[model samples]
Target: MSDVNVIPDMIADPSAFEDDAAFRLKAAQAAIRRECGWHVMPNTALSGVINTRGGSVIRLPARHVTSIESLTDRDGNKLAYAYDPETGLVESLSGGFPAGIAAIRYEIHAGYDDAPDVQSVLISAAKRAGMSPVGLVTSQSTNGSSASFDVVSLMQAEKDKLKPYRLGGLP
Candidate 1:
């Protein structure tokens, strides 16, 4: 993932801002993931643990789950489960999972293989960051030229595009 460039070629000239672009892209990706509450890009064989709510159905802390490599109880006993790959909803076939903190362990592949909407958000953020002058100047003027930097943030429309990927019922 580190070697992959999420920023599109049409967004900026890679040759001129190679290092800066990489840095900004990374920052933007992190911000997006933080906002969305999960990794929006594909991650294979990722291990995760979640507490059970004492039900047959449990929601994994992810979206677009592709596969489940393993599912186990707190005692390391293998558990049978059925899951919806798109919703991350897992149902235990071996009765309900016990209620406890981090009682379920799972290894799964989840998220989009390629999310263009997410990429667009990243590009927008990176571009905003790249254009702003360093430090905290909201507005600057020199030699009859002036510039104003709007704080870099996801627009409402961008946030709307990410809604489906967000966790914890946040809008």
Candidate 2:
């Protein structure tokens, strides 16, 4: 996935970000991607490999796939397939994928062109990381005040918003 610096512009004051803000933002992006099981922003072509256990239907390791640039087997043989752009499901038209490690290689365009909810979640996470004192403060209390930070992970609300874009089954 490409490095997208959207958090800086999303913030009301870019200066509010600390010196480690870039790192924090990157970490936030990575965390979201990890949760989603794919790069969920900036639609682009990505090359990847998937192992299959002899199945006609193979789900790509991505979401919102716009197109498949190429799909080949281990022997570099192009395979005929049909795919759903929304769910990343590919149906083999010729035959089921052979069972093996790294049996399929593909280049595909996937992810969202404009996902405001995803961007919002990323910004929220980045801001939370920036405000943390030790970068690991899950919960803290001072005098009569108490606060908890999700830190590198998403809160339940954020996860709910991103559920549709998530890969595999359930978060």
Candidate 3:
């Protein structure tokens, strides 16, 4: 993890009035607005993680997203989400998002807990579903573990492609 600066949420010193709560709040709001504005637009490309219920969007570098898939209960069974290298962001969603996504893992997850190992599961699932996993890379995250690809792109891509979906449940 990168060093997280823990600045006091609010400065109390009156001498710091020029740098006081109101100014800081405005600055913070402006910064958030800028990022939120970016989220409202799509970039050339993007990548992120979606949870088991098909919710939870985690934005990371595009290169970090390792897989994607369209899920199905074809066998009259609920399938577990898996990672697919070929079904990576640029290739898979470039045409359009898969009908059902089991899960999307970022390069950062490699070697962490259930992550890196899930890469193989993703590949198998994609094959079973008749999709291909490509552009897969063994890399590290900003934290420097055996990470996978998160999403990568200009601000616009995520805004357009990923933002509208609700988190924590099916669409």
Candidate 4:
């Protein structure tokens, strides 16, 4: 994902914008991720303590949590626990975690693995973002009322790809 040139398809034609394709593609990827609320990565982290949903089920706020290293109480004292790698739910094999704020501690490696359809999201975002001089600006709206070139280029279908990765509920 470092070099946007490797992305199979971008909204803008590679031929049309020649030199700026890579830059635009990269920008689009970042923008789409921000809009989608997928900030997880293997090295990144998402942590929380169980309060109401107490017992073995730990609430992990992020997606793609790979592993849980250690569980600790509010005092940072290490505790024994087991976590399911697939579901990211940690089970207290030893006992139950205290129901409180930040009562349990576990270091987790979390991040988005980029779904199979992620390429489509990138391409859609790239199409509307990174306007090169190639596109002619016939009508420019100062008040920003539907005539914006960016708005015209963006299609609802492209934004739809980001629905699955949304942070909480409908935005």
lDDT of 1 by residue, 1-171 (tens): 343433333323323534367777777787788889888896556797888777899888887778788889888889888887655678889878878998988888877888888889989987887776762234444432444434356768878888877975532
Candidate 2 stretches with Cα past 4 Å from truth are 1-19, 136-151, 169-171
Q: What is the model-wide C-alpha lDDT for candidate 4?
A: 0.56
The candidate 1 region of ten consecutive residues with least summed lDDT is 6-15
Query: Which one is best on TM-score?
Result: 2
Top-lDDT candidate index: 2
TM-score of each prediction? 0.73, 0.76, 0.20, 0.50
Spell out the clash pairs found in candidate 2: none
Instruction: Give the alpha carbon lDDT tens digit for every residue of 1-171 in model 2.
Output: 644632222233333544377877887899899888889898998997888997899998888888889999988999999986655678999868777899999999888899999999999988887777666344444432444544577889988888988897532
lDDT of each: 0.73, 0.79, 0.31, 0.56
User: For model 4, what is the alpha-carbon lDDT of residue 66?
Assistant: 70
Clashes found in each candidate (C-alpha, N, C closer than 3 A)? 0, 0, 28, 3
Show model 3 residue runs off by greater than 4 Å.
Answer: 1-9, 20-49, 55-103, 107-171
Distance from true position, residue 138, model 3, in Å? 50
- RMSD, one per candidate, in order: 10.4, 10.2, 20.6, 10.9
lDDT head-to-head 1 vs 3, winner: 1
